[model samples]
Target: MDFDLTPPTEEMEKFRQEVRTWLEENIAEEMKESLDADEFTEEKYWYWREKHKELARKGWLNPTYPKEYGGGGLTGAHEAVIVQEMRRARACPNLSNRRPPETIMVWGTEEQKQKFLAPLLTAQMTCWQKLTEPSSGSDLASYQSTAVRDGDDWVLNGSNVFISGRGPGPAGGPDYLFGPMLTDPQAPRHRNLGYFAIPVRGPGVEIRSMNLIVGRDSHFVFLNDVRVPGDHLIGGDHQGWQVLSTQLEQEHGGDGGGGQALAPDQSVENLITYARQTKINGRSLGSDPLVEQSTEEAYIDSHIDKLFSKRAYWIHESGSQLAHEGGLSHLSDKVCGIRNANRVRDVMGPYGLLGIKDHLAPHGGTQEIQLRRAIALSHLAGSLNIAKVVLARRMGISRTQERAAPMRTSGAKAAH
Candidate 1:
């Protein structure tokens, strides 16, 4: 389908065609086969990783971001065309490229940008975020992890949990997992945070793969007294919070609107495909009235979320700084996670009630994993309660009002 794209410059279009041709020609046959088998071995994954860098080296992945920083420096319209083509091809975007550097480039110093953005854009090194402590979850500001300054180094001590895809997704690929951290202790709780572009592998950094309820192993990373140079500090020392908020704003939706990055949509599509194919009794699962209703609800929720998110993205792309509603982006992200959990749970049902593999009873497999994953979603993404809190706060309803009105119970109660 031809999308109403922002027309690319003639040169950009020429570059696009060249890229499409190159991907068709050079993306390895073995990697394609591995992706088909859902076998993301390090070797097969590296094939795709190399391809991402090749594109990056050519300035095709994030064109219009900035030429100096290894972005193509194209307009948003041009980016739309790139995204549309990648989607149409059923090929992944350069997932390894997007968020962290974009966050850094926007808020990092010229030195910070020079240090991280160029290498990131050129695919020289990979970075992962270190936020969300064991204690902090979605109340990220309350993080117990501290980056106290020690001479020219910042001694880091904390653990970040439920970080995603340290290896790859269903299809083999490199992980793009980078984040902001708390840097300045002297600043206020919200204001003292700082962002860092840390690699997945570092001397003091350790990532342990977690087998999720679903089939994948995301990671849990522990940073123990890791020493990062002061120059690696993004957006200055105490200004960490300033940089951190900008990154969170981007993560919640886009810079301005409520759009998320890639994974959420892919997850929804996966569930929808399952609904279309999986059957109960004689009828296709997609045909059953209840299934259809769930399907419609899922679709509606996904589209509404996407629309709001895209709107948010454009607002940010246009240099706007405010969410239309104060915490709408966070609320939208919360909705996306909950909807994903609910949609998958409704379709999968009692089987999903079974928890993780290690705890699986005699009759266990998909259901156990699904159920556990569904439960974990509430915690892994923003907690269900956090979403309500954001939504309540944004709507200008006091906590007392919320308690009195008695909104739906959160995942905490549902888990029981």
Candidate 2:
């Protein structure tokens, strides 16, 4: 658990103790025991949702956001304590993180925050973002969804594919979902859009499942004249680009939560352990020099990802100008995911996936599952290409700023 990282200071130590004590007192004993079980079951998922709800009510989930929006109103330091404790317990974090709520808080009006965000922070509701279209994955700004104003309401019409939490799941259902659409198709590129909060169960909305090899519950959604209230508009009309930027920042960026700024790479560590124990060809798999080399590479890559992401989060929390750091951090994660999954699979050979649903396979054949996910993730979250472009643009901006500074100095001298 130590991982030989920086030691906790007095305040951090106290806070760590506080979180540990709170979990012990608040979490159900049976729930804790079930979480520790090897076999994942329906009960495990159900209890995980219950745990999420409990964390939401306690405001620990959105710790760094404003309390008015149902957040914990804690600083980045406080959030780090919560994350450390969760990891200390060896809990696998649910994918439903604080991003959805954080995005709304960034761009929503006071009324919108009251209507939508308050419910989210307290687990009274959940939300899904409709950004990725059937064809638009990396080119997210070129989404085909459209929203036409109809009296005081707006009519939304478009389709989205591969939506993560579309219909039903263990966490129940989402109350509403955010949609970004073209308000004026005739208007220029980024200026002709709008963002709206549409009801999931509302009329004119259609959703279908997208069956992936990893058994994820993603969906394809269609909106046909779905009416959104006037107040549902976020970031004002035709200002969707601004809202989108903020949303993506929160999605890809991490506000420093002390040391809990990034996800741990447990999969690699687990893979290494499996190889050390499992025998292949009458010898331990780890005995192979190639497998040992690949495992070491993966282990190092995992740690590097955490370090890169942590620095980016610190930049965000410090309110400094974010320099391609968010995009680069995210890019590293997705790329590492792809490389590690492939390398580990190759090292495990057929044993990693041979008996996927039977014995003899390592980690219950979850590596096979991870391989499928890694393939999908590589294409998701802005794609590796888009992330690269983001970083490049930041570099261009830096150069532009440098040039403008000298010109401004010359102009000041002339005025004098």
Candidate 3:
């Protein structure tokens, strides 16, 4: 594998300085404190909104998007500088969160772009992927959240589980849902889906929080008779499934699951610290060859994950279409993250399950917290099996695209 990374040009450096300056000023102290404390209270949610708006207004949030709709209209290289700066500041969200707006720009109507995509540029709204169902385990086609046509409106009914929407970040950006638009209960399996946005705060929309390990939480949203206008639909009627497939492929190809990138990656560092503090026969735990080996493996996997993600980001950001890179990166990230967590647990043994208040818990019990999160990550965003399927299809070893195409087209034809 090529280990070389492209160096930023002088222009990028100037942009970097400009970005750093803006972040230094606009990133609030309280928001920073919240991140340090890993707190996501309602107050912190409001802060996420403000921060997103500022970043949007400054054209930093949508750096690679067309400037006409609140983006900076930049290239991959430009976004890299912005990302580098944001990573250094420990502000912003995962690269995945940054993708929905781009998808809106691509598949949404011009008006939709203006109303919804524009805010993404300016951080005026926060969007979550409300795709998972109580019964569907990492299967988008199996989504049972039905949106039936009612006069000029679409009345939605059903519940989505495992939505990873934190309280609007530290900004007051109201939450929205990017999920399946097709809801015909009798439709064929893969065809009964299209993607669209639904205002999560609308009437009949009830979101109950589900706590993860530590202070983190996911959401369970119930869309009970929540009505959305036909205008909110993305792509042609029943064209949603196809559009959604394209979006996922593009997301994997381009961003490698890059969302808002709000949090820093401190899992490996915390594990290392824990190992150093631990004692086996009064010697540093890290001194033990087995422990050292485990830590080294984690360090390597984490490094590979970052590099793989960067490569995928570079491919997508450079205006290239990714066939396998996105899936590869995503698969690697999940594998590496889960693997690293297990390794840490092995290193810590019983103490890895300790709570933050426990004296035996190292790094405020981050290892234990990570174990919980790691387990969730297995199936949360996308399961390993799902990633592998995507990768295999992208690599032409699987005929899912062919199977899916026929199903998607049949659904569209049925709608007509």
Candidate 4:
């Protein structure tokens, strides 16, 4: 087993140069400056959206996706180069809500794919994953949101909290919202649900922003008797658990082989810079052996996290059976994030806690935001304990061996 990454071929190298040149010439300075902003503003949101549309037009947004669906229809290596160059330019567009489109590609009918997936893949619209409800966060099977069958539509009624999406103002909300809804009250746990795609601007769909310690653009979504066309229901009625498993697998880091290297965590890099620049007793703080050692540890931990993700990505691209790999990547990211946060605080003390509002905040207050994220990440995708349990189950270290969830790939692979 060679642990080294295969070097890019000549064709790949040429493609990389092409991507780098395109990004350098096209990415606006405003967009580059926005990357350092403390929070994503309404102006910044639209700026990024325009950039997303630009990439979509070039078919680079979903490069590995089939060309017929408005993707570049490129290979995984090509996609990796696009991702790498985009990150190198610090102009990567936000395409985080990928679960819906990927799920649709797997279980949807032809009409559904054309209707839902094309817009999503092409960046014609945005989407939000309404998974966590007011009553259930981790235990998704216990979701109380109900979708009752109507003549030719499904009437959804429930509230979801901490829902994430792009855009800021009411006019800037996502074009679609998707998640599991209880369909059969009398049925078994996994069989009682239906997955749906609800239009955010449609009647009875309401969104209210939630204020948090950190400035994350999260919201509370209220669906009151929201009517969704029957065709919008995916994977057939009562088979939502199966469709959801695909999305959850990706979300939990099971689908790490998305043909791109994980982007380096900016916060870690900024922390290192802070340690090297800040003065202590007329010498750089990083010059102190203790502070230097701690900073290096943080860097090492972040690198390890990226490696776990890379391995998972490689396994998926190789078409090998991917069990426990995604879990390992997800678990490593969460744990390493916590560890790095502690290291930052230990070295920088109170300065690490300063927000963007503070005049003295370092790196545009990203360190402060990272510390908050470290606290919130444990509960966001899945808790650290939940990640551990899932990894154990996937690795067959439990009472009963649990198989990894099935994932269906579309022409253009969804980004994690």
Using lDDT, give the best candidate's number: 4
Candidate lDDT (C-alpha), each: 0.57, 0.68, 0.67, 0.78
TM value for model 3:
0.83
Q: What digit string (tens of lDDT, one per residue) describes model 1 on residues 252-353?
A: 433423222322355466567767867679767888888778877877676666655556556555554442332465466565656666776787675445
Give the runs in model 2 whose Cα sits over 4 Å from its true position.
1-6, 21-50, 87-97, 166-172, 253-263, 279-284, 354-356, 397-416
For model 4, the stretches where C-alpha displacement exceeds 4 angstroms are 1-10, 33-38, 170-172, 257-261, 410-416
- Write the number of the candidate with greater TM-score, choosing between 1 and 2: 2
> Residue 252: error of model 2 in Å?
4.0
| TM-score against truth, every candidate | 0.72, 0.83, 0.83, 0.90
Count clashing residue pairs in model 1: 20
By summed lDDT, which 10 consecutive residues of candidate 1 come out lowest?
407-416
Tens-digit per-residue lDDT, 1-416, candidate 3 = 54325455787778878988988887876665332235555665666667777776777777767778887777666666676678667674532255466567667667888888877677766777776788875667777777788898888888876666566442222367787855666778766776768886668887776665534446677878888898877876566676666456544434644422222357887778878987779899999899999998987788778777877666555545456777788788778878998898898888888867788777767677678778777664567888888788877899765222111112122232
lDDT of 2 by residue, 346-410 (tens): 88777766535667767766677677778877766577776666656655753332111111001
RMSD of each: 8.9, 6.4, 4.8, 3.5
Q: Which stretches of model 3 miss by more than 4 angstroms? A: 1-14, 33-38, 92-96, 168-173, 213-216, 250-254, 259-265, 273-284, 349-352, 358-360, 399-416
Better of 2 and 4 by lDDT: 4
Question: What digit string (tens of lDDT, one per residue) describes model 4 on residues 245-312?
Answer: 87888778866736444455677888888988898789999998999999999888888787888887
C-alpha lDDT of residue 10 in model 4: 93
Model 3 / residue 136 / CA error / Å: 2.5
Instruction: Name the candidate, 1 or 3, with the larger lDDT value.
Output: 3
